[model samples]
Target: MSMGRARSVVLIGMEGHLIEVEADIGQSLPAFVLLGLPDAALRESQDRIRSAAKNTGIELPRRRLTINLFPASLPKSGSSLDLSILVAAWAAEAHVAGTAKVVFLAELGLDGRLRPVKGVLPAVRAAAQAGAETVVVAAENAQEAALVRGVEVLAAEHALQVASYFRAPGAVEVPADPAQEIQRVTPGSPHAEPSAGGEAAKDLADVRGQAEARFALELAAAGGHHMLLMGAPGAGKTMLAERLPSILPPLNEEESMAVTAISSISSGAASVTRLQRRRPFEAPHHSATAPSLLGGGSRIPGPGAVTRAHCGVLFLDEAPEFPRSVLDSLRQPLETGRITLHRSAGQVTYPARFQLVMASNPCLCGLNVGSGTQCSCTVAQRRNYLYRLSGPLLDRIDLQVQVERPHSAALALQQPGESSAEVARRVAQARAVQTERLAAFGLSLNAEVPMNLLSEQLRLPSKEVRALDAALDRAQLSLRGYVRVLRLAWTISDLFLKDHPEADEIDAAMVLRQSAGVRT
Candidate 1:
């Protein structure tokens, strides 16, 4: 028996494993065998590796090569393990040794060039977590990997280049970041539109003639509350939803990384860079499936639109038209700030801490009490239309505002309101105040205040506390609803520069909570 050894790596979901690739060479037959519970994508890596080996001028022995991926029962998926497997098979067959120092991961192109693989950022992080010494990956993913500290990383363009690095460590030069050569980027947008840099982002200023709706939106952003907008078809409800993210707070470094990870798990490495700069704006069609909204399928469970919109906005247009079950699925996440999908294989938890911005017509006919249109649907039809939105779902929503169609005079007379940047500054101020006020309790935003801690941390005077007690008793608010109102009251006070939400703050917030909201 002649023994040859080679080393290689495989990237699992947001993690990297140093795989033991052992190749046992025998003279019985020239057949190749791979013993590992690899998924279909990985099963096909043999051809890619073989072609890349031939193109890179690596000779394969004309004898049986039995390759084993150690941690034998662990499920392996994706072609990312191809390079590691190839190297391991070759090393064992060629009797190569002392490769344990280098960690290698990449997909091999037929031309022998090293192509970028998915989850490279997470994979690199996983390696760092495991105290890996040195890591080599595709040149394209080097910049992302370099973000982590404590590990020496080398990126190369082709398989031979990486192999050469292993053969002579510290000899191969790591490429510098070519960001200047890359296009000038707008930080919030990943994909470049021809007019992206020049065009303006959708702003709150674009929404017009809906003062109450605007106030509701501000409160929602200020307190991280969910909002529901009821209006006629042409009332700019959708436009308002689109602009919510712009007025909200920007993501911090840690939040940005978490957001990018969710995106990465969705579309792989390319996803990591895209759709992460800005707060996610996901508007699923009314006809989406439960899995499409909540996440599930054959492989590992992917993040749903709600999870993607974490630390962002989930805009559900035509909200009442969505399947009741899909809409109801939101209740758990809305309260818990995360969703867990339990499959027989395992449970996948994703952050669902997002502001839900839902817009729906007041009635099935798209108009029940607004301008430029008359009510056509029967009373039952209108009631049934609104009925589709179950009470449990509606109750979870923190703020519900009715948006009326623009007045003929208002539409004709006004210019666009203040720009998004102008409003974002004010919103940022309110958020800062919340951060300061809650700093003592290790909290920032008002919405994060749980009821158990509210009386202690946000302790109000007896008069104000009694008013809240009366409101809760009269309104029959759930434990969740009571906390949401307190959060909203706090936001309203901050908006008006009040130190604490006094009786007036409570009153102003009560108007929004009243059963007799202005329907028109």
Candidate 2:
């Protein structure tokens, strides 16, 4: 009887904790005991590990065996630790060489095959950060684990392959399975290929008219600000929102990895092969519940639409039709750029720094805005319908624009406005200017700049300041509204290539703020 040890990782949300796997064998009645706070899936791994070891020509001694996950209070979950536990148990009775410096991450099939598991990228990252010398993963996850530099990745298809690799270095080679072997790549590697048939080619020119809405969309894209579009049905509100992503700048390498990782975990994969630079866009239905939008689960809280839309857009059509509670759930993430879910098990936080775009009709009838004659609802009814959107929630939106129906003449002409490519060029230029200016503060866009920084360092001229002061004195804007307008002003300045916002820019921002159909 002997003792053996190995290492693995436990993923809690996106973070990973390195764990030590220890196995002890003793001469007693045949029994296997597992210690540490393990979830149901993990508890069942003992059966799988035993079957896999037997199938792979390795025999466990017919004696009392104990497996203990060190840091037992950490609450380990999932089947990813199967390989580590099996290796440790095998090493207890055999002379397995070179098994000291490698972390194992894979599920063991009953037939001794290695199966891929989720969160391998983050797990490998954690191991690397903890100074692990090497990582062993399934062949399906080899490319993903290879993304983390400074660690040697050994990928195998079966338990026998792993054992052979450890017993004699360079003895076992990864089997060539074209369908399963994703090409190895490192983060920011030039060899990384873009997704095929990437996001459908949406163009802004599809919309007939509503120049005001088009301008607002551009501003939102330029500064990464939240926006609202109010119009009657068939007034191009949805079209404008759908095309907004087309004109936004492509995500950088760091942002791409982050967005990709969230999508991977949400889809139950270690990594997605088709990585794209295009930003994510999510439009959950109005009937979505608070948990679906903010993320919740009985055991591990998953990322919701807001978190999935990180560094991108989250659009809500028919915004007023959504429940008040669901709408209110966004307030915290909007302010802090992240969502924290406190479940009975524990708390998990996910990044939700997304631009919000909401659209709704002016009234319940969907025709009250165009002509009062076509509306059947009374004034009070119309007011109450819009009143569903509370003041604090509306205050968080920076741009509010009224989208009117296009004139008959404009529709007949069918003249397309600027294409997405043309608008995207200007938006990218404006974003570059903002990034350069705000890099010192660790900010990337005007919307994220703090109010104090705006007042102390990014303030406008004296005349513009006095104009804003007069507007504040008249109670035309709240303090929060004031800061939002200033942020919008900066966006306007950046769009027009100005050193700083002036009276004209401030006035433009005020126009947007006052366009909120419902008065605060």
Q: Largest lDDT belongs to which candidate?
A: 2
Kindly list the per-residue Cα lDDT of model 1 for residues 483-511, writing each as its tens digit: 66777889899877789988878777766
What lDDT tens digits, residue by residue, belong to model 2 across residues 1-520? 3888889998888778899998889889988899999999999998998898788776677888899998898888999999999888876765355565679999999988999998787788889999997898887777677766788777778887777555533333333333544233444554433444374768998887777788899999999989999888999899899899899988877787677767767876545655547888899999999999999888879889999999899999999999988998899999999998888888889999999999999899888874568988899989998888887899888898888889998888889888999999999999999999999999989989888998888877688767787888899877888898899999999999998888989999888877755563
- In candidate 1, position 388 carries an lDDT of 86
* Most accurate candidate by TM-score: 2
lDDT of 2: 0.84
lDDT of 1: 0.70
Model 1 TM-score (2 dp): 0.85
By summed lDDT, the worst window of 10 consecutive residues in model 1 runs over 189-198
- Once superposed on the true structure, which residue ranges of model 1 sit more than 4 Å away at CA? 1-18, 26-28, 93-98, 168-200, 268-275, 370-373, 455-457, 465-483, 514-520
- Specify the poorest-scoring 10-residue window by lDDT in model 2: 168-177
Candidate 1 at residue 323, lDDT? Answer: 94
TM agreement with the true structure for every prediction:
0.85, 0.90
